[model samples]
Target: MIESKRRRRTVANIATYFVLAGLSMFCIGPMIWMLLTSLKYEADIVTQTMQYIPRRVTFDNYVAIWTQSGFPRLIGNSITVTFLTVTICVATGTLAAYAFSRFAFRGRTQLMLGYLVVRMFPAVMMIIPLYVVMRGVGLVDSRFGLALAYTSFLLPLFVWMLKGFFDSAPRELESAARIDGSTRLGAMVRIVMPLARNGLVASSVFIAIAAWNEFLFALMLTTGQGSRTWPVGLQLMVGEFQLPWGVLAAGGILSILPVVVLFAIVQRTMVQGLTAGAIKG
Candidate 1:
């Protein structure tokens, strides 16, 4: 009976490995294809049949996209907008979340519900009104305008998510600090903030990723290279006569690099925060 049970366990392990391997292949197949296509020449890419492997690997597509297109400017704009949006969301959301989590006040539940509802509102519905307001304010074709719009859209989410994390935090830590002569604000900053570092990092990562990938607003609100983000710039690569698949793929690869790097850096903190919040809550 023990031998039979062991065999069953070994079979389950093998099945699990096979399933995981298949899922990994499915996820990575497109990325591998993109890399290979990016290295291939236009002639090879445009042929009737696709080439899984390129005869000649070259950085020419990357170079062309960088030098010929205004990719550098687009990258800069994306970075600027994402950075500002993340900073604003993190700052405002952290304070707002702490207030909601720690303090008791009238209409607090209503206010939190309001934030969640606003977050649920679709961005497409707000585009027309936002465009008009941006136009009225002379911010139609500006990075500042795009960043502000992204922050507004992202802040509600950050507030809701961070509030959950802050709610799960132990109140005793803050109370101890206060008992030791720390002011309320000082206790929050020095003690609570440090304890909630994982949540803060997770929220920041989400906001940054959102801001970086924002397309509709960036495309509509911004014009020309001055405020165009990478997503918009990448769309412009397809010309009337021909589409540059290699360049587009290279640009896509470049665009995702920062997000990949960021996740690699903060993945541990994000996982820890999310797990802690789940367990505590």
Candidate 2:
């Protein structure tokens, strides 16, 4: 009886593994298709029946995209805006989170609620007003302006997420640091910040992804290649009559690579940060 039960349990485990593997493949199948499509020749892409595997995989699509599409400029603009936005979000969010988590001042709860409300406000509603304000401030068509706008929009989310992580941190560590000789700011920098690395990483990833993919604001605010991001550049590939599928696919794959690498690097920290808040709460 014991032997039979053990065998049954082992079979169940095998079945579970197969199910999970299948699901993972299903999720990743489109991405695999995109990569394959990006490498296929333009003629092969328009064939009668879709071929899962490319008959003749060529680097021409990538090369064409690089040489003809001005992807380098788009990539540079994306990196600049994403990096700047992430920096601002992380810096300001950490400070705001620390304040919200560590202190109890007048109207603190109300202020936090207000921030949440601002986050919920539709981007569409604010776009016109934001454009007008940006024009008034002479910020239109500037990378700095776009970064500032993204930072403001993303900061509230970072604050909410980081605040949860900070609240989960042990208060004793800060108290002990204070008792030893550290000021509040010093303790935060030396003790609290180190403990919240996971949270910071997680917040940075979120902010980077958002800023990198932002299109609506970038489209309306910026006019030329100087400020145009990858999304905007990709949209430019769609002409009046025809769209270059291969080039578009190549551009998408390239655009997604950095974010994928980033997530792979910080995935562990992101998971820990996300779950730590839930467990602590």
Candidate 3:
């Protein structure tokens, strides 16, 4: 019986590893193809036969996108919008989440549920109302306006995710800080926030990624190159008569660098926070 169980466990482990490997390949295959395509010349890419490997590698695509196209401006706009979105979401979401986690008030449950309702609505549904409001307020066609649009959708998500993390933080610590003459906000800043710092990082990264890759709102909100983001700018690269695949691929690669660097810097912290939240919340 023991021997049979051991054999079964080994087989299960092998199957799990195979499944994981296959999924990893599925997710990473497109990225690898894009990177390879970016390195190839236009002639090599637009070939008669399937060319998995590049005949020649060149940095010309990168140079052209950077120097010739408005891609740099788009990248700058994406960065600016992402910064603003993450900053606003984190600042407000943290406080709102802490309130939900600590305080009991009338309609608290209903309010939290309302946030979930906001998230449930399709993003497209909000566009008309947002456009009308933005136009009325003279915020249309601006990066800050785009950032505000992102905040409308992402703030609820940030609050919900962060409330879970805040819930995991011990109330006893805050109470102890209060006894030590710390104000409520001081207790949160000095004690609860430190404890939940990892959770905060995880939530901020999530919001930042959403803001970076968001396209529809960016496309709808901004008309000019001055405010358009990378995704929209890349889409506009496809002309009526021609498709610049190599340039687009190069742009895609360049566009991902900021996110990649962000992940590299915060990988350990984000991982710890996510794992801790999973276990604790």
Candidate 4:
């Protein structure tokens, strides 16, 4: 019976691995194709036959997109706005999360629920109100304005995520720190935060990616090349009479590099953060 059960488990594991591999390929297939297409010449892209592999690789498409268009400006704006959004979320969300995790204040439950309520509404519903507020404050068509717009929606998510991580950290340690002459903020900074660093990184990366790829807010908030993000810029590159597949592919590849690099840097931490609560010691 033991041998039979082991054999069945082995077979199930093999099937699971195969399914995971297929799904990974399905998700990553388009990215691989895009990278190959970006490396191809314009002539090789719109071929009579489906050219899976490029006969010749060229950097002309990358050059054309970088030099001919306002893509660089768009990239710069995206970086700036994404940075600002992540900074604001981290700065504010961390404190709010800590408060919710540690305190027994009045209406705490209601306040946390309100944060969820903000996220429950479709983002589209807030566009008009946001536009009016941003315009009134002379912030429309600016990178900072766009970042603020992203924060309006992403902050609640950041707080909720970090709050879960904080909950995992023991309150005993915090109380011990307070007894040792540490203030509430000091206890959090010294005791709770280090334990939850992975969670903070994961939360920041989530909002950063959201801000980086956000198109609707970027479109509605900004007007000129100075503040427009890469998504909007890439969309604008598509002309009525012209479809520069190679250029678009190159732009797509370039746009994802930052996110890929970010994941590579924090991948281990993110994995730990995600699985932190699954197995408690």
Q: Top model by TM-score, which number?
A: 3
Select the stronger candidate by lDDT from 2 and 4. 4
Ten residues in sequence with the least summed lDDT for candidate 4: 272-281
How much is the lDDT of residue 250 in candidate 4? Answer: 96
Q: In model 4, where do residues sit more than 4 Å from their true spots?
A: 1-18, 271-281
Model 3 residue runs over 4 Å out of place are 1-14, 271-281
Clashing pairs in 2: none
Looking at model 1, which ten-residue stretch has the lowest summed lDDT?
Answer: 272-281
Better of 3 and 4 by lDDT: 4
lDDT of 3 at 115: 90
- Which is better, 1 or 2, measured by lDDT? 2
lDDT of 3 by residue, 1-281 (tens): 99999999999999999999999999999999999999999999988899999988999999999999999899999999999999999889999999999999999999999998988888899889989999999888999999999999999999998999889887887899999999999999998888888888888988898999999999899999889999999999999999999999999999888888777756788566433452345
After superposition, candidate 2 runs with Cα above 4 Å error:
1-26, 270-281
Which parts of model 1 have CA positions greater than 4 angstroms off? Answer: 1-15, 271-281
**TM-scores of all models?**
0.90, 0.88, 0.92, 0.91
- Could you tell me the lDDT of residue 277 within candidate 4? 50
For model 1 the TM-score comes to: 0.90
List pairs with backbone clashes in candidate 3: none
Clashes of each: 0, 0, 0, 0
* CA lDDT of every candidate: 0.87, 0.88, 0.91, 0.92
